[model samples]
Target: MSKVVLITGGSSGIGKSIGEFLTQKGFIVYGTSRNPENYPDSQFSLLPLDVKDVKTIEKTVSTIIEKEGKIDVVINNAGAGITGPIEETPEAEIKANFETNFYGPINVIKTVLPQMRIQNSGLIINITSIAGYMGLPYRAIYSASKGALELVTEAFRMELKGFNINMTNVAPGDFATNIAAGRYHVPLNEVSPYLKPYGNTLDLMNAHVDSGSDPNMMAKAIFKIMNTKNPKVHYKVGAFMQKFSIVLKRILPDTVYEKLLMNHYKL
Candidate 1:
């Protein structure tokens, strides 16, 4: 039988590539995006959805279930980025970021879990980031939201272990995606004095994003994970440096790693 897969934020970037790739591989793929018109109709069915809205999530899942009868996989890839020091970021901005990046996936999972549990088999892939593991200088709020998401991913993995459900977290490094271009920013003028020193780091972050790994590579990694008989809990995808960074952080002392990161950013 063909596997049925649903992907959120699947109009473009990594999500779109994954949906296209999976569709070509013979999976019955459905992709959701806020702007459903942006998705190509020939490749995969497009559903209108805003991950931040619970009603939208519930309706989308209901429609998919009604059409397909069974959902084999759900990829929570709809998320946004906020770039600014935490102090400079307004509470409203922080809440909005969390609503999209953190709560959005949580809501989707909650809506889908009941059906998955009854079926006793399902795969969930969360497209998180390396920021989930470590904090960066400028994107404090973004990092926090991802960190929270990672924790949720871990918890779900353990909780769902006995239910015959699988959860995988893809922690990708900086990728050449529209995320950088679409990132929300707040003016530093209104922030507390404590956040002033991080301005230079934010500039460097923006520059680094322009030269990050290709989104296609990340999509390929996700494809491989989805096809696995038994996928691991976490997979990191990026350049050699990113792989090395994760390794170095694991082995190096806190002070040593901090120094390396600071030097790398010229801080």
Candidate 2:
């Protein structure tokens, strides 16, 4: 029997790529977007779901279960990107980022756990970020939001272990996607102290995404994880340095690591 898979934020970018790949592999793939109508040519089903809205999430999950009878895999791929200096970033924007990146995934997981538990087996993959491993300048909120989800996944794995519902985080580095266009960027202020560094960092971030690896790479990585009988709690897919940065953080002294990051970002 083909396993049914649900991918949030499936309309485009990594989610769409993953959905298309899994569909090609014979999985019953369903992807979610706030506006499903926009994608008329998607390879798999595109359902309406807003991760920030629990009501919409509940509805989407209910619709999926009704149609498929069981959901074997769920990829929490829906997340928002926010870029701004912490001090200059509005309080509302920070909270909004968390609502979509952290609380959103948690709610989706919460809604699906009961169905998964009843089925006796399931897999939940949270799409995190390489940035989540460390605080990135001007993107502190985005880092915090994804980092919080990473930690939550750690706890969730242990909590759900006995029930056979495997949960893990897949942290990706820069991927060529429309994420740069979708991000909420705090406007560069003329007189703010962070204007120079923040603007430069934003440009660099955008350039990285423009030259980043294909999203299909993420698709292949996710497909592999799904096939594994026992997936590890954390898997990272990205450029060598991006993945290695995590290692560097672990081994380097606090100030040294900070300096490295500051130097790289030219702060």
Best by lDDT: 2
Model 1: per-residue lDDT, tens digit, 42-151? Answer: 37888999988899999999999999898989999998988776666789989999999999999999999999999999999998888877776677788899889888
TM-score of 1: 0.92
Best by TM-score: 2
Candidate 1 error regions (>4 Å): 40-42, 188-199
Every candidate's lDDT:
0.85, 0.95
Off by over 4 Å in 2: none
Model 2 C-alpha lDDT per residue in residues 1-267, reported as the tens digit of each score: 999999999999999999999999999999999999999999999999999899999998999899889999999999999998898888999999999999999999999999999999999999999999999999899999999999999999999989999999999999999999999999999999998999999999999999999999999999999999999989999899999999999999989999999999999
Q: Kindly give the number of clashing pairs for every candidate.
A: 0, 0
lDDT of 2: 0.95
